[model samples]
Target: MTNVLLDAHLNAKLADFAGSSLDGSPLLVVVTKSHRRPGDTCCVEADISAFASTLYTIVTGQSPYHDLSDYKIDERFVHGSFPQTDSLGPLGKLISRCWRDEYPDSKSVCKEIQGMC
Candidate 1:
């Protein structure tokens, strides 16, 4: 029982994010201009999804890091932002498509995403 908690907005975001990332992909990409990208890290969608989902769980009191999908997965192997050249394979692309499809309109995207994440 991981006592996770999350703000109202984040919860919604997580849901949108999860829904976006639910497709069958080995990895998903995330690029945050605010954050520093590690030289030996890649931002795959699944990693982003897993990170957000687990973090959301941690915040909302649903699950724990230990209980989420494989936590050992890391981006350091690819050393990039899951670029097309990054070689994430078809699964990654599939996840990317799902994610894009899930992208809500700006008017509702934020609020919807916040509700899940």
Candidate 2:
């Protein structure tokens, strides 16, 4: 398992690294990025970047980028550093990015919700 660094509010902790566990567990997917790297070698970020970004947004119905001033969400590609499946930072922010991108405006959001409903 690879151990990547996580920037916590207080301090970063060392945790085990897993991959694509999202397909099985929503809880694990939500917390995948926050997970600390147990060692200092492996990096699931590279391995699951493409899929992780997309999966995260689709599952949470949120964005995937941290700073999305001029961004848009698309299940096809949310490339960049992330927590789960990636090693960005807070999975929440990233998921939000995906949502914003997926739904560029209020109209889109309603449409998305309607589709889900």
Candidate 3:
């Protein structure tokens, strides 16, 4: 449908996924082919959005970029223009910083999350 509708759906899905406590591990680790953290990429938004998107996938069993088929998904990622879902709620804002290259490393991200919870 519309971009707004897709974003709303993704946000709802993110909330569902990120809102609950994990069964065992407090933090989830994601590894990508490129050694750098997704957010480590030049485009801060792509990295941050990648982390959020991963959480969205875990919770919703769908791709956060599912809506954009016409454009090369990779291009969208490189430009850091992907739509963000509100599923992480407040956490989403914190993680957004990661995308923006605010935090120095994952350790900082962890510390921030721990402080938040």
Candidate 4:
């Protein structure tokens, strides 16, 4: 499971590094809620959010908002309606913080994760 999580994390990071096209065609499955808004650009917070979402996917064996259509997913994220993380324990709390933009940057998220170890 740890290996799966690490692989997913690396893949998500690679996709992010590849950069989004003008049409925003990249990693929409793990995009931050703020980035779903019009004219919003990627930021450190976005990276944290994406990483959190990726972790959620790996841990749960499913994508966040998996039941929703792309349009509906965008609408839900724009409205701050993320899937529940209550059952996920500590990791869920971390994911919640990232989705809520509570962390200032990825380093902060990394520190928190390191502490979890």
Q: Using TM-score, give the best candidate's number.
A: 4
Q: Residue by residue across 1-117, what tens digits does model 4's lDDT show? A: 122323644553243334454564544444343234323445566556667777888788877887777788778767778889999999999998888889997788889999999
Tens-place lDDT digits, model 2, residues 2-110? 2333465744454554433534342233232322211221233323333334445545555344444322322213443343433434453444444334434445434
Give the lDDT of residue 39 in candidate 4.
Answer: 32
Give the TM-scores of the predictions, in the order they appear: 0.21, 0.21, 0.46, 0.70
**Candidate 2 RMSD to the correct structure:** 16.7
Q: How accurate locally, in lDDT, is each candidate?
A: 0.34, 0.38, 0.49, 0.68
Question: Sorted on lDDT, highest at the top, how do the candidates line up?
Answer: 4, 3, 2, 1
Q: After superposition, how far is residue 68 of candidate 2 from its true place, in Å?
A: 1.4
lDDT, candidate 3, residue 2?
A: 12
Model 4, global lDDT: 0.68
Candidate 2 residue runs with Cα over 4 Å from true position: 1-47, 70-117
Instruction: State in Å the error of residue 41, model 1.
Output: 6.8
lDDT: worst 10-residue window of model 3: 30-39
Give the better candidate number (2 or 4) by TM-score.
4
> Per-residue lDDT for 117 in model 2?
43
- Positional deviation of residue 18's Cα in model 2 after best superposition, in angstroms: 30
Please list all clashing residue pairs in model 3, or write none if there are none.
Answer: 11-86, 14-87, 15-87, 39-47, 44-99, 48-99
